[model samples]
Target: MADNEFQSFLTELRRGSLTLAVLGCLQESYYGYGLLQAMREKLIDIEANTLYPLLRRLESQGLLLSQWDTSESRPRKYYEISEKGRLVYKELLAEWRKMQSSIDSICGEGEEDERFN
Candidate 1:
């Protein structure tokens, strides 16, 4: 594949993980920028515009709670998973495992991908 095509392929991996990362990071309260930084630490190159909308969507789904923190000089909106979100996260994890097992059964276990570790 060409360089651009390969880059696009790698970008595909980012799609499936976004929701998981958002849900996982918000386990503790974090604002948009903090969540972006945390995702970067985990090697996800997510943009703020994309992430903010996603956060809003998740919040709308009753999966998250957000509150504006006015304690600091600059106020920030922090987010955390609600009880429903925790339950949803658990379901996602179970589905993810099942999906991976089904894929492995078809695709074989001998991948060089570090994600398998």
Candidate 2:
């Protein structure tokens, strides 16, 4: 693959996981910057530009709840996973695990003994 094509593939791959990652992280309430920092701490590396829009979309989809915290130095919008979000996260996590297992099977991972059969 050319460099640009490979980059495009990688972008598409990462885009699928962004929703899962954002939803998982919102299990605990966090403001935008705080959530960005938390994802970075987890080695996920999402940009502010990308994350803010996603947060809005999730909220609009009724998967998240948000409130403005004005008691702080600067008012910040805090987000948390709603009941619907938790259910969606659970379903997504199961689907992800199933896909991983299928990929492993295709690769014959942990099937060292079977390789000789």
Using lDDT as the measure, the top candidate is 2
Model 2: per-residue Cα lDDT over 1-117, one tens digit each: 799999888889888689999999999999999999999999996889999999999999999999999999999999999999999999998998898789889987867668888
TM-score of every candidate relative to the true structure: 0.81, 0.87
lDDT of 1 by residue, 1-117 (tens): 799999888778666668877898889999999999998898888988889999999999999999999999999999999999999888887888898899898877777366658
Runs of candidate 2 exceeding 4 Å displacement = 108-117
- Candidate 1 to native Cα RMSD, angstroms: 3.1
Of candidate 1, the 10-residue stretch with the lowest lDDT total is: 107-116
RMSD of 2: 4.6
lDDT, model 2: 0.93
